[model samples]
Each structure stands twice: as structure tokens, then as C-alpha cells.
Target chain A: AVAAPAIAQSAPTIKWRLASSFPKSLDTIFAAAEVVAQHVKAATGGKFDIQIFAAGELVPGLGVLDAVKDGTVECCHTAGYYFIGKDPTFAFDAAIPFGLNSRQQNAWLWEGGGMELLRDFFKDYNIHNIPCGNTGTQMGGWYRKELKTLADLKGLKMRIGGLGGPVLARLGVVPQQIAAGDIYPALEKGTIDAVEWVGPYDDEKLGFNKVAKYYYYPGFWEGSAQLSLYINQKKFQELPKEYQQILEDACAYAHLEMQARYDIKNVNALRRLAAAGTQLRAFSKEVMSAANKEAFAMYDEYSAKNPKWKKIYEPWKKFRDDELLWFGVAEKSFDDFVHSTRGGKR
Target chain B: AVAAPAIAQSAPTIKWRLASSFPKSLDTIFAAAEVVAQHVKAATGGKFDIQIFAAGELVPGLGVLDAVKDGTVECCHTAGYYFIGKDPTFAFDAAIPFGLNSRQQNAWLWEGGGMELLRDFFKDYNIHNIPCGNTGTQMGGWYRKELKTLADLKGLKMRIGGLGGPVLARLGVVPQQIAAGDIYPALEKGTIDAVEWVGPYDDEKLGFNKVAKYYYYPGFWEGSAQLSLYINQKKFQELPKEYQQILEDACAYAHLEMQARYDIKNVNALRRLAAAGTQLRAFSKEVMSAANKEAFAMYDEYSAKNPKWKKIYEPWKKFRDDELLWFGVAEKSFDDFVHSTRGGKR
Candidate 1:
């Protein structure tokens, strides 16, 4: 037995193609996929290589999931909710109306049994999902007119995306799922009354503040809009375990990196936006309350029809309730007192 | 009318002391203060300078808020929940058990009326708060014994911190709020049966996994643990508006950078931990359910007694509920399927 020497096995080289749903112009979101590619190549010493394509370069911006599912692309960087038209459940993989904020979403995905559930769902689509990045609770949108009440939503044509679009539609919003590139034009030309983008940094770069004066807060539809890496199931399985681990690590890195970029850039952009006379407004109580009601009603209807929704919803809801109860006392009280005070300057 | 040529006023040179809750050994959290200092100096061309002190250098690690409030330090870099003993509400500012994960916290703080509410809270403490960094949903902790059921938690003495310590205590586990430096010693000496530090990256550095064989998942309490920059309000007002804006931008930059470091570092450390025979375990359902019940009862009792808690809890709870209802349908459905499928390899 000692006479036989074990041969060291080298990992097989893997080449992957990642098509991003976002345009190259949107650096933070698009760069997330690039970050993953760079990390994978470096971590594996180039044993694994991923070629990334911007939206419309390889396929339509919204066609990424399907492209990955059909093996047209090995992977994709996209918002899971974008494919809600195919199955409403897809929204959890990305962003949902009044869903978990970025942190909560990350918690749900990474820790709160969310990752397992999502992986199972993606199996049906022949894809595996990893949260790549998140736009921390987005702004409501860039509005031509300030929304003062729930009535402001009625008949309003807005450029939005994912499950939120349909939820908004319930509030009498004429939801238009426009590509990123098309949004500015739509708002500029008055084709849409409003547009909800990531936040101030992206909004400033897009020059939406110039076209729309009123920028609303609490992107309730997307408390945290997560961007995901969807890989073809077969392609994922073919890779060596180390390569698989590297991809996962890279995606996680990209996930945090994207948020950091947004946080840093948003502050400066917000100052600039404010300087440029962008009117920042919180969503009116009437509007937020109405949207909240519609959002819940929609969920009840979906859960009744969708067993998948019900299965996870039960546990998830219970966890969320418990979380809220604790936060209400400890988290809320301290924040209230400290945030209200005025003191000496640094 | 041409405004009379106004003389450009030179900005005042300012120096500040920042007391950090974390030791320098934890580079990511500790480095946030340094990053903010660097950014402020660079942005203001060194006219504004900040000196950062690690835990116990200026004051005890946990006394940062008081130091900032009493003007002992010009600023502090610490989690809000560290001071929850003063008021449970502080947990919301930092992290609450089962609260908003990192992204959701950011949403609440930055967009969802959280900042305003928190700022109101901070006013009492004489601090101006800006989020400096975030640890996206943290790990449950490192344990000496495998947690297979609720029984494992009973009588377990764990070195944990923040709001989680109390929630864990309610689960029949003895929770010890130990400082970062003391965690290793406590675990090694049998003074604590287990320790829940950050994720594997920090855990490996601290060598906790070396002693604790069982590593758990889903830190229910700290979905997203936030590190904040608490500035002396009076000192903040003294800075020029441009400098103030620069400081805010710097905090935002650090916030993103810290998370990036953690996300990249955690996986490798996790792999190393696994290789080193650290058993990974999920918190048992019974334990989780029991903790949830205790967490809620604690909150209801506190809400009834604490006015500050009641005021904010009402809104925060409502918002969280509404958010969950919407996410339950689309997000939960997709995640349940995807996560259960294939270890989310894709």
C-alpha cells in the first residue's frame, strides 16, 4: 500500500461568460460583475476566467436570467425581481415592494435561511443565485411634481422595475419598466411622470435632478434592492470545489464593494443635488400608508396562490416579527434620544 | 446687482480626538476611524485633522458615547448598541436582535426616516451621528459545543455583546458582555462556554475558532451591525459647510470600505476554520423560536415603560411589518427555492 504514490490533481480551467443587466455607464452595478471576474481570476491564478458583457452587448438588458437559464451566458448580474413577470416569486432574489432593506436582505440571504430557499427556487430556472450587491434602500424616484398625497400616484406613469412595478400599479400607478438608459429620456421627454433610480450619486450622474425637481425618499418598493449573480446550474456544477468557493467569495466581495461605492458617492452627489436645487421630500403619509396597504394585500393574494411563497413566508414572517419586537425597545429608544440632541461641533 | 467682492474667509484649522470602541487588532472596524480622519485631512488639506485612539487608550471601549457626550473626545467610532444598557433603544441605532440587516439599517438610517429619528435620539447625547461602517449580517458565533437543539443553549455561558447578549440570556443561556480583548481569554479559561465574535475573518485573527469547535450561523440579533461616527455637535457646527460636507463624505467612504474588508476576509477565514475542524452548525429551530418569544416579550415590556421606545417603536415596527409583508411573496418564494437547491453554488 505504501508503494503507490498519490498523484496531485490540478483543477480544470473554467471559462465563463457573464452578461450584466445594467449598462456599462452604470459603474457601481455593472462593476459588481467585473469585480467577481477579477477576484475569480486572481484567486484561482487565472485557472478560472469570466468574460463580462454589458447590457445589450450580449443580449437585452432584461434578458440576463433567461440567457443564463438557456446557457446563452454562463452567468449574469441582475436584479432578481426583474423577472417577476415570469414568476412573482423571483422578486425575493432581487428587490421587492417594501422588502428587506439592504442589510435585512443580506441577513435573510446569508443567514436567515434565505440563501437555501433562493438556491432551491433558482434550481427550477436552472440557475444558482448569489447576492452580488445592493443599492441600499433606493430613493422613491425623481418626480416632476411633488407627491403630496396618495392621489399623486393615481394615473401617474412612472419608470420603475421588478415586483414594485406591479405593486405600484395597484396604487393606480401606470408602471413602466424602462431600461436604465431609457429612463432619463423618458423623464426628460415627459413620457414618464417619475423615475426611481438607485440614489443621489447615480441620480446626479444621470442628471435626473436637472430634469425633475422633486426627489422623494423611502423607496419603499426597494428598501434594499439586491443585485444577484445568476449562474447556469450545469456550469456551476462542472467547476471544481475550489473554483466554486472562489466564485462565492468573489460575489460576496463584490456585494459589499458595490454598496460602499454607492454610500461614498451618494453623499457627495446628494450635496451636489441639494446645491442644484433638487427638492428632497419624504413620501407623504397618505401615499406611504396607501402603498403599504396595497403591498400587504398583494402579498396575501400571492401567498394564497403560491405554495413557494407560503412555505418560506411563514418562518420568515415569524422571524421578522420577533426581530421587530426586540428592536422596538432597545434600538428605537436609544436612536430617538441621541438623534434629537444638538451639541458642540467637531 | 454685482455682489461687492466678498473676501474669501479662510477655514479654521481644527484638530479632533476620536475614541474607537474596537482594538486596532480588528483592522476593519478600527481602520474606519483612521479612514475618516485621513479623508477629513485630505479634503480640508490638513486644515482639519483627527487623531484616532483604539479601545482603552482614551477611555474604556464601551464608554465612547459618554466620552463624546461629555466632550472627553471630539468623536467616537462605535456601535450604538454597545450603550444599550442605558436605553434599549440604542440597539436600533447600532443593531437589534432580529433587526434590519446592514442594507435595511442603512435604508432606515439614510432614507426611511431613521436618520431623523436617530438624530433626534442623538441630540440628547450631544452627538451628531453619521454611519461610518457596517458589518453585513454577522455570524451567530463560535461555540465550544455543537448546537443541535434548544437544549444546547441552556446553561451555556457565552461572551457576547450588544443587544444580542440579552436576547441570548433570555434563551436560558448565560450571556457575558465581554470586551474584544477579553473574548479569547474568556473562551479559553472556561469562564465563558462560547463566544460570538464577528465572522470567521475576525474570529480567525482572534483565534477563537482554535478553541471553539462549533461555529454557528445566522446571528439573529445582529442582522447588520453598524459602526457610527459620533461627533460632538458643537464642534461639528464650527466647521465650514464645505468641511462638514467633506466629513460626511469621508464617513460614507469608510462605511463602505469596512464592509468590503469584512466580506473579502470572512470567506477565507471560514474555509480555514472548516479545515481546522471547526464544526459549522445552524442555530436550532427550538432555540431560535424560544429566543424569538423572549425577544418580543422583552420589547413589549420595555415599550410599555419607555416613552422613547414607544414613540419610535410604533413607526419602526409598522414599517418593518409592511416591508416584510411585501417581501414575503416575491422575495421569500424565490429565496426558498434557490437556497434549498444546491448550496447556492451558482
Candidate 2:
């Protein structure tokens, strides 16, 4: 048997409660919190434990940011955009329309000085944000009718999330902020003309295909939606340095896991959706082009109006542009070729 | 102040030595080992410490696999394809010519059953593998002269890494294997007509642009190269469960960190290279198509002769195809649109 070292004798036991903005039914997104908790607990020899509470268990889904900010829970898992009403800057922590994709988002936050900039911004809100998950590129919502042109989007009642609502609102879309559970019924009853939850896996679970015949490609608002862990600043500061490092590392682990889970799961889910006759349609270039123009205009206007948004937006935009140039050279050419010439007969 | 828990008293202290296949000057790749070590130490309050040794400090760079396998070192960070001379099957652990890109590779290993298959294979070598880093799709290589057609490759002497050599050999190219530090001198002196050494950041450090102005794109050979931590299975199983979990999570943290570092760093390096008059060229569609055909034929030949290769290649191929289909839809469409309409004039 091995002897316990002197260092272990000084390690403290602590417990934390994590509130998740997602329902347990959305396993891919919700599982990120579980992954963090599992790794943190296992690494700490159970000395540190985090109990998870699904949406509405501790607070309503949309209330998680405030719950974490006020220390109602020690931490919470949420998309930054969910709290955009508080400050449009929150969208940068998750995603904005026509922003970075999953890998590029990760590159921006982790290496392109985005974290440092955002950490400074988050100080005002009394929270610390760490990326915990990402839904690759989401499918555009299920449309009750095919949207073949920019004109088709006019007056469409869509249950969109976060800043996407405002961007869509520019294009004559009547954006409704319905809770996840309510989306199915709203779409079925024609109360909402369109809905986009996540990708194929999560959407299939919610049965959106049963109501909407046309499923779209590329949710422009969320080229990739990143989810974050928001820690109560005071509560986080109280933890031992070791525990703090463990928490950050655990979140990184979850971030990679969540993306991997979505990538593979979405592949099979999409194939199944296709087999069952879900009509997959790409947003026409006319719609995509117009949306692209509006998204940047929105960002430009925010830059002029909001100093906090401007601080992060300037660097973030440069990083995105640089990334696009580099990826265009090798990554795009390679992927386009390999994907076009898929290896299997299947 | 909080009191120490009884659980802390039972935690054991441990130390490990890590061998890296990269020189310290290659910070992005070498930093992965440091990232793992730093987190493991900080999270354990220095109770569990890991010391990193750069290439040749513990053993030669190419000898890391053997060092870890024989228990000469507790673990080592290196690319699996480096040992293909022992068995071509090792390529799956890193990259095969025209294989999955970085994200797809992570998805395959972590979620698409590739890890389980690889674990079973590694058991025979008495090692446990954990992904530590990935260099996203690499540049083809730097050439002294531009090659426009398949005929230009005939009898050309080039220094390439791992399985890429054999693939290139089929096109009448004579492949040279040279260490990273030696590649520049060889290219400068015209000892080799070309050399493919990673992407822009690392290549810039080597000053390849000064010697070879013709830099090619879409390294069809290494679409993405994954680096792994290979630990002695006996050493891993002997650790306390908590330490094992900590070590695994640390590798995952490093895995994400390394990729992000590359994604950001490469962007600036490429811009610098372009400004310095580095000629960026794409492999002709004719060349890309022929190389691609040869690559699949080679894989088919291996499957016909090698049972181990057959077992893994079949499933891996299917997963690759499914991924290609899924990515081609939304990811390709979104990225194509965004890149074509870059936000900045710069």
C-alpha cells in the first residue's frame, strides 16, 4: 500500500452547485456540465463535488446568468447570448450572426486574446466565463414552408435565440423567444412559422420534423454556438488555487468532448433524418448574402454605440478575418476536395 | 478558512517524466507537453508533478514510442505515424494520406469508436494512448521550383514525413527522410528538391521561405496530424484512480490548447510569408485527383494483406465518409459563404 503524502493532508473538501440552462433531454449540451463535474470530482478524489441542476430546478433556463452573477448558484452552464438582453456584449461569449465557426471560435477565445478581453468585460458583471461546449454549425430552423428567397422570410414567426432575433428582425422576421419545451407545440399549432433548436440530433428528439417539412442548412446566426460556464466571481475566488486550476481544466475537457459528441452524433442523426424524408434545403444565396450584409452592419453599429462591445469586437473581427484568409488557403481547399470525393460507396 | 477533509489524507503523491518528440524551439507542439505538465502539477497542488524532456534529452525524437513502450520513460509525446516502419497500422493513430481533418479526427477517435479500436491495438504494444495535440491541415511543402503537372514530380527528391513518403513515391517521387533541424540546410543546399515541414509558423522559424519560394497547399498526405501521449500501461494502471483521471484530463486540455495555438499563430505567419514574396500554389486538380486515387488504392492493398489494418480501416473509412457528407452540407456551405465574403479589406 502507498502512503498518503503531506500535501494531501492540506487539501480541502468543497461542494458546488452548477445550474444548467439546458434541459436534461438535450444530452449533448447538458452533458458538458456533467463532463466537467465528473472530471473535477474524479480528479479531486471526491474532495471537490459539483451537483448539477437542470433548467428550472434552481432557476428558469434564461435566468442562469443572473443566478450565477448573484451567487444563487456557485456556477451555471449557459450560452453567453442567452443574457444578451443585459448587454449585447454577452453574444461575443457565445456567438453572433456570421461570426466564427466552432474551431475558429475556440481559436479566438483561447489564443487570439479573446479570453483576456472578455475576462475584463465580465468583471463588470461579477462573473468569470470559461468555454464548456459548442454545437458545430447548426441547421437553419425547420420551416413550415420552403424559404427559397429573401422575400420568403418576411413576417415569418420564428423561435430564434439570442441576438439572432434582432438580426432576423431586420429581414422582416418576427422573432419569438419561446422556451425549448414550448417550441414543438408552438410550431405545430402554427403559432410559430419556424424553429431552430440545435442540429439533427437534438432536433430529432424534439420531433420538429413531424410538423415542419422543410429543414434548412446553415443557421447563419449561429455558425457555431459556444456554451460557457459562468462562475460566481466571489465564490470562485474563495476556492483554493488548486481547485481553481482543476475547474478550468475540467471545462476545457468538456469543451472538446461536447464538440466531438456533436460532430459524430450529428452525422448519424442527419443520415437518419434524410432516410425518414426530412427535406434538407440550403438557404438560397440571396438569403445568405442579405443576412451576411445585415449581420456585419449590426456588428458595425454596435461598435459605434457600445464601448464594451467595441473593445472586444475590434480584436475579434481582425482575428476572424485572419483566420478566414488562412483557412481559405489550405483547410478549405482540402476539405472541399475530400468531402467532394467521399471515400465510401455508402 | 476551510478545514482539510479525511479524503485528502488518503491521496498519494506521484511524479512522472515525459519525453517529447519536438525541440523546445517548436513551442506550439512542444507546449502541449508543458501544458499537460503545468495543469497536472497545479491541479494536484504539486502532489502529482510531471517533468518534460525535449527531443534527445531523454531519447532521440523518433525513439519516444520505444522509450514509453519499454518503460524507459513513463510517457512520451509524439506522432504515431512516426513509427510506420514498424507497422503501417500506426498511421491511424495520427494521420494517413488524405485522412480526416483535425476536427473529424478528434470526432473519430473520441466518439466514432476509433479510440476503442486503437486501444485494443495499443494493448499489444503495452502502451495507453491519449491525444495531446493536432496541427490542423498542413501545407504541402516548400519547393525550390514550382511544379505544375504530375510529370514535374517524376524522380523529384523531397523530404517528407511518415506515410506521406510512400504515397508520394507512387508518383515517381524519391522521398527523403530528414530531421526537422536538418531539413532547412538540406533544402538550402539543394540536397533535396523540396521539404514539407509542418505549416507556416514552424516553417517560418526554420527560414524555409528564404530557400524555397514555392510553397504548396493542401498537404493531401497529412490533412491533419495528431500528436499523442503514449504512457506505459503498467505505470498508468498503478496510479491512484484520481491521478489517472487527472493525467487523462490534462492531456485533453493540452490537446485543445495546441490546436488553438496553431490556429491563431499560423494566421500571422502566413500573412508574413505572403508579404515576403512566398509564392503560394495549389496542387493541380489533376495532381490532387491522381494522388487521391493512389492513396485509396494503397489503403485497399493494405486491407487485403493486413488483418489489423483491415479491421480498423474499414470502420475508420465509413466514419470518414459519413463525416464528409455531414460537413459538406452545412459546414462547407457556411464556411464557403463567409470566406468568399470576407469582412475586412485588409
Candidate 3:
């Protein structure tokens, strides 16, 4: 009897380049791209490989999406909200002022159909997107002087990212979208009154505490900032089934790792910042309330005019409302009590 | 000058019970206490309270030490590595095998560390102790059945837990000490042939993929697993801290949540054993050979020299190391590759 023909299994090899909007100095953010490249190479047994380039390497930082959409590069790591100038609805893909926290974002994306909604949005730009990481709730910003009331925000110029700029502008504040490298000099030169980067870990490294005496809590603009990996839609579809799954799995692993690293690192940095006399303060009640009002108003205006924003915003807002109600009754009450008590010290 | 009279800030009140050990479900091994009292009541603006438990409820499942030691709780949620039976170091803390797997000895325990670890090993058991969970890691669990060479296992079974089990049992396989909940129950069971478990996320939940087939991973000697809540040395001191941090934190959060729940859920739960029939097998030639040799050799040598182990092992060894490490890199490489490939399949 003739032996059954042996099965042949071999995968095609492919190479691509990835550009990131972030600088290498921020390890967690920059590492997401590295993780994707590493996993894909290992899974395909060297059959497929991707090279990564940090911000400004092949294109200007904010120009990443344009480059990818135009086929200048194969993929890019970025926060979709950065391109809100093109379409305000893009902010929902990353974060919005006073929006969902990290866990909520994950729930919405993976289970609440947010991914599908966002993917549909991305088709316009010709990219296939996958969430790769999240920076949990972030600290407000750093200021040269303590913000005591609403009056303090008048004409205050600060460097901020995403749609937060416009919301703050409504509150009589001027917002600037400065790159990471340029932030330190601007703050040192007093060209800006304040700035909001990430939390303590990144802030400490940036030496913001030394330049800005008042560090505020609750970065209303980005309760939880989500990061995404944008692959050329056509290029992503070309990969074998297994290679694609590996990419997704790697992204999930990196997502968890980034959060864990930030949680641990932020605690130590916060303690250090406090010891350095960084003057931690809560955002003034007036400032907080005003900002919230303006944020919702802006959202309402966007929904009335932007069909894309309206489609996702309605369901997204409802989900957030329901989740808040449930957490308010249990998580909040428990956290408030334990955190307020001396016995709850971590 | 008049001294300003000191004013006390009233403490906030709150109540909560956390169930954990192995994230969520996986009962007996991690969810024992909820089986006790799920309702928790608190007064003083919801200040004082008492309720059910879970691993990491009051203390990290691994840190039942400081939690019980510092009066953070009146009880705890935990397993023995969890204290190491506290110093051959605390082997009797859980189970010993050629040891126990679930049924063999609810007979040995409830009668063993069930008493000994709490009495001799845990002299300060002023707190109540109980048998809350157990999973007999299936004997010589999960393996890749096509071992044509003994060298295949020069270092295998890399996913054991605790210091004693992994270190002592290094024959032809490398012993890995992972947490109970994470073992899979390792990649559907066959991912790593010969894993030890509290029993089923062991053989069942993790359904060794139809790929590997050999269901020889569970190390049987783990007959019965034991968990405990070590109370504070001092505040088991005060009649009440108000059921406050003590009773509220312990009984409500840790003590009763680990094992019993795991048992209830894991029973006869192997219906999905493998959509594809699984080949149940045993450890083979040269493979089992090298393990027995290395396990005992390491034990005897360590006992002869280390006073710590000598003090604990005289009685701890029957269940101590007799395992082996095989010489192969397939498990690690395969795992890394497979995980990376998961999301790619979409």
C-alpha cells in the first residue's frame, strides 16, 4: 500500500515597519511595539518580521496616521484621540475628559461592542486597530502655582494632549499640544503656566515636580488613557491565521503588563514626589465643576452635528452610566471608608 | 499663649468582603469562605463589619503572614506554601505525595496539617483554622505523549508551586511553582505533561489540547490541600478592634473563602474533558527514573546540611521531592509561540 502523502506546512515570510508616536524614553508605551514585533517573529519561526521606529524617526510624531494611511509605513502606535482635529469622534477611541477608567475601557472594548464601533470608524483611515495598553486613572497636571479657584484658570496656558485642550479652552485656559522633548524647556522657560503629562512616574522623570509646585489630582481629561496599535488594513489581512492570533495575544499580554508596571511604579514615584515638597492638591471645586459642565456641553454639540460621534456616544454614555451606578454602591463606598481610615494604609 | 485644642477627624465607615485566591471561581482551592457567610453587616455609618472571605481578601493569598501578624484581620484566606508549613519549612502546611489528590485523604488531613501545621507548625493558631479547599493535582499530570527519547524530559513539569515541591522534585523535569488558580488547569492540561494540582483546573478546566493527548500531569500525592487564616498575635489581644479590622477583615474577607467552595464547584465537573478523546497515560522509562533519583538525593543532601529543612523534614519527607527534570526546551518554546499565536487567529 502506498504511504499517505506527508502534509507540508510552511508559512510565507513578510517584513514591515512600524512607527510610534511616542519616544523611547517612555518604556511602557514604547515597549508595546517591541512586544508585538517580538511575538510575531517568534510565533512565525522567523517567517514574519516587523521593525519599529520611535517618534520622529521616519515621520513627525503626530503625522503617524497620515503616514500609515498613505502607505508610507505599515503600522503605527498611537492614541486615536490625537487626530480629533480630523474628526472629534476620534477621541472616544482613546479617552475623553471625565470618561471611563481603565477597567471600564476594557469592558467596553472587549465585551460592549466598542471595538467594532471604533473599527468601523478606522475604516475611513484605512487602518486595522487593536488596543495594546492603558494608563489607568491619571493625575491632573503640574502648575507653577496652586489653583485655588475658577479665577486661577483664566488665561492659564498649559500643554495638554487630545480633546482636553478645547474643553479647557472653554474654561478660559489656553492649551498647547507639545511633544515630549519640548515640554521640559517650555515649562522651565515659564512659557506655559502648567502641563499635564502622565502621572508621577513619568512626571518625576520629566522633573515636572521641580518646575511645577502644585500637582493636582484627577486628570479629568483622561481618566484612563488607552493606546492602540494601528496596522495597515491591507497588510494585516495578508497574514496567516495563526500569525494574526499571535499578534492579538501579544497585544493582550502587553496590555496587562503596561498596567501592572504603571501601578507599581506610580506608587513609589508619588511617595518620592511628596517627599520632594511637590505640593499635591485637589483641583478646586469651581474649576472641576466648570470643566465637567463644558465637557458634556461639548459632547452634546459634537453629537448633534457629527453622525459618527452620535452613533457611538449614545451607547457608550449609557454603559458608563450603568457601570457607575453599580460601582458607586459597592466599590466607592468600600474604597472611601478603607482609604480614609489609618488602618487602610497600603 | 493658648494651645489649640486637638480635634480628631471622624473616621469614615464602610463594609466589604472580597473573594479571591485564584482570581474568581476555582472554588475549594480559592473560594472557601463565601461558603460560610456571604452577608456582612456594618454599623457606625457602616463602619464596623464582619462577613465572608477569599484569598487576598485581607492579605495577599501569599501574604496571610503580615495580615494575620499585624492585626489586619481576625482571620485569613490561604493555602500552606502560603506559610510552607512556616519553616522543613512548613511542608505539612498542605499535602505531601506520591501524596494526596482530593479523595485519598480528606482522610489524612482534617487529621494532618489539619491539626499539626496549626498546632506544631502554627503554634500561634489563636485564630480559628479549617479545611476550606483541596485539589489533588492529578498524578504525573499533563505530558506530550510522543516522548521517543528520555532526553525529552531532562527538565520538564516546569509548573509546580512553592519552594519545597519544585526544588526537591528535580529528576528529569524542571519543577515550576505556579499559583493554584493559574495551572489550568497549563494550556488545556497537555501543554505540560505531568502537572500537579488541587485536582481539576488540573485535568479538566484546562483540557490538555487534543494536540498533546497525554493526561499524565497531576501529581497524586497532593491528596488533600489545606488553607488557614493566621490571626494577629496581639489583637486576637482585644475582644474587638469591633469585629472591625479583625473579624471584619478576616472572617469576612479571608478565613472562610478558600477551599470548601473550590470542592463544591470542582466535583464531577470533567464533562468537557476534551471534545477530542484524551489519552490517559503514565510517566515512562528513563523519564520517571531520573526524577525519583534527583528528588530523594536532593532531600537527603539538604536534610544532612541545612538545619532549617532538617528541623522540618524529619516528618516532611515522605511527601518531599522525588521528581526529575527532563532535557528539552519544547515546553517553553511551544508555550511562548502558542500564546503569541492565540489572538492572531481571528
For lDDT, the strongest prediction is 2
Model 3, B173-255: lDDT tens per residue?
56766665565546455445545443434346554344355555324334345554444444444433222222322232222
lDDT of 2 by residue, B1-346 (tens): 3223433767666789999999999999999999998888877777787889999998999999999999999999999999899889999998998899999998998889999999999988899999999999999999999998999999889999878899889999999988887898899899999998899999999999999999999898889999999999999998887778888888888998898999989988999999999999999998888889899999999999999999999999999888888887777788978977865333
Write model 1 residue lDDT over A80-190, tens digit each, in one string: 877887888888877767666555566566546778888997899999888898876677778999887788789999988777787889989999877676788889999
**TM-score for predicted model 1 compared with the true structure:** 0.55
TM-score of each: 0.55, 0.97, 0.53
List the candidate 3 regions with Cα displacement exceeding 4 Å.
A1-8, A343-346, B1-346
lDDT of 3 by residue, A1-346 (tens): 2211111132456788999998899887888788767655653445557899999999987999999898899899999888999998888888998777665676677656688999998999999998877776677889998888898888999999888899999988999878787898899899998999988878898998888898887787887788998888988887755456556655654565465456545655777888899886667657766887898899999999999999999998876664453333222322222222223232
Q: Kindly list the per-residue Cα lDDT of model 1 for residues B95-151, writing each as its tens digit.
A: 777666565566566545778888898899999998888876677888877877787
Model 2 residue B121 CA deviation (Å) reads: 1.1
Candidates 2 and 3 compared: the better one by DockQ is: 2
Best by DockQ: 2
lDDT of all predictions:
0.72, 0.89, 0.58
Model 2, position B32, has a per-residue lDDT of: 96
Q: Pick the candidate with the highest TM-score.
A: 2
Please rank every candidate by TM-score, starting with the best. Answer: 2, 1, 3
Please estimate how well model 2 matches the true structure, expressed as its whole-model Cα lDDT: 0.89
